[model samples]
Target: MKKEFLANLAEILEVKETDITPDMKLGEKVWDSLALLAVAAAFDSIYDKVIPVKTIGKCNTVQELLDLVEEDD
Candidate 1:
């Protein structure tokens, strides 16, 4: 799931997978409104949870975003 998430995010942002680091924040110029929307949709479709855009916007890194949707198990 993590692999798919990273791949999808990289694709959505039109960047190479190698370019995305765990510490890279999505709020960077690379993530425009459309990218955020796409990420919101991805979270819903992949995690079965509709994460709010504002919440997602607060994320500081790829790892942080992934951690947001991580199950508590």
Candidate 2:
């Protein structure tokens, strides 16, 4: 994932950048309900994408979450 994106997410989730990784699971200790909302808002604000909560629900890792927000190439 992009470093800037990772940093932005880490800040939103209130975790250190070092703590975030592709394998990191969402809804774990650091990613709670408020963090989930922040993720949604981040996508909307950064990418203008409206990510469905259902889609977020299915993501198991930080990579999955980034995939949800990243623009298609």
Best by TM-score: 1
Residue 21 C-alpha lDDT in model 2: 80
> Can you write out model 2's per-residue Cα lDDT over 1-73, one digit (the tens) per residue?
4787789888998878898887887766476667778888888888788987667767889888887777573
**Model 1 worst lDDT run, 10 consecutive residues:** 20-29
Candidate 2 clash total? 0
Can you list the residue pairs that collide in candidate 1?
Answer: none
Best candidate per lDDT, number?
A: 1
For model 2, where is the 10-residue window of minimal lDDT? 26-35
Those runs of model 2 whose alpha carbons end farther than 4 Å from true positions after fitting are 71-73
Per-residue lDDT value at 60 in model 1: 79
Please report the TM-score between candidate 1 and the true structure. Answer: 0.83
Per-candidate clash tally: 0, 0
lDDT of 1 by residue, 1-73 (tens): 7787788789878899887877876666398778888889988887787889998888879988788778553
